[model samples]
Target: MATPEFVLSLREKIGHDPLPLVGVTAIVFRDEKVLIGRRADNGRWQPVSGIVDPGEEPADAVVRECREEAGVTVRATRLALVQQVPRITYANGDQVDYLDLVFRCDWVSGEPHPADGELTEVGFYGLGELTDVAHEHVRKIALAVAEDDPASFVGGR
Candidate 1:
């Protein structure tokens, strides 16, 4: 998707100054594997995630993101984890800090594929097979498979 309208308008006023944003990631599991994707914007091999639109519930945003980015329908089963991202400078020069909401979701329908410009590839992966990703992602995947309750991982990283 294009840069969010709110964000674009905000940038027009404040330039690239870092802003705190909320986002959601999906840990969509099926059979014995979890869904992951390579971001079209950054080539990051990670879980499907997106910035939450203004006034959107985090879980709803995650489900919408899963479909938009990965072409899969998912039912979020639980809030999985919450992670605080340090400031990041996007390649486009927009800077932001993200409060991340990670959700554990069950596969609902459709095969994983790059459904939009936000993703270049999408597939299910076994935990042992995930690599070259941020350690927190790996940790969240492992946690999702092994736990039932939501986890709060306040981080400084």
Candidate 2:
């Protein structure tokens, strides 16, 4: 996994200190199937996600992450969720509490491909048939698919 250069630099100065960060994840749907990518580092399938870069909008970040990670273009249909995750420590010794924004996205174009080094596989799956996804992620997808309102938020309080 290639850690961002800026993040790596910050870790050098403040080793493992929990930095509060923001990120976005896209639940991209095409033909009623949601897209999931197998992470290269963990080999587990999850939605396309990434940290919201400095000065970037969360919606824009999700679109960019989807294109880079899965070689697919998407448009945000709604801001689906906002969750402030407690501190999470990565195997690489980096720590952060992420305010992750989940976006319901509509697929615009392109097929699934591992365009970036982050993912090894990218494919679509039905909501009831997902495997290898984290427990919270399963709920996230289900809520995104079932909910009609744009302001719906799913997170542990």
Top candidate by lDDT: 1
For model 2, residues 4-58, the per-residue Cα lDDT tens digits are 7777788889998888889888999998899998999888889998998888888
lDDT of 1 by residue, 1-157 (tens): 5889999889999998998899888989998999988887778899998999999999999999988888899998888788788789988788999998888999999999898888888899887788777887887787677547657677655
lDDT of 1 at 17: 92
TM-score result, candidate 1: 0.91
Q: Model 2, 74: alpha-carbon shift in Å?
A: 0.3
Alpha-carbon local distance difference test for all models: 0.86, 0.85
Mark the regions of model 2 whose C-alpha exceeds 4 Å error after superposition.
154-157
Clashing pairs in 1: none
Off by over 4 Å in 1: 155-157
Model 2: which ten-residue window has the lowest total lDDT?
146-155
Model 2 TM-score, all chains together: 0.91
Tell me how far the alpha carbon of residue 52 in candidate 2 is from the true structure, in angstroms, after superposition: 0.6
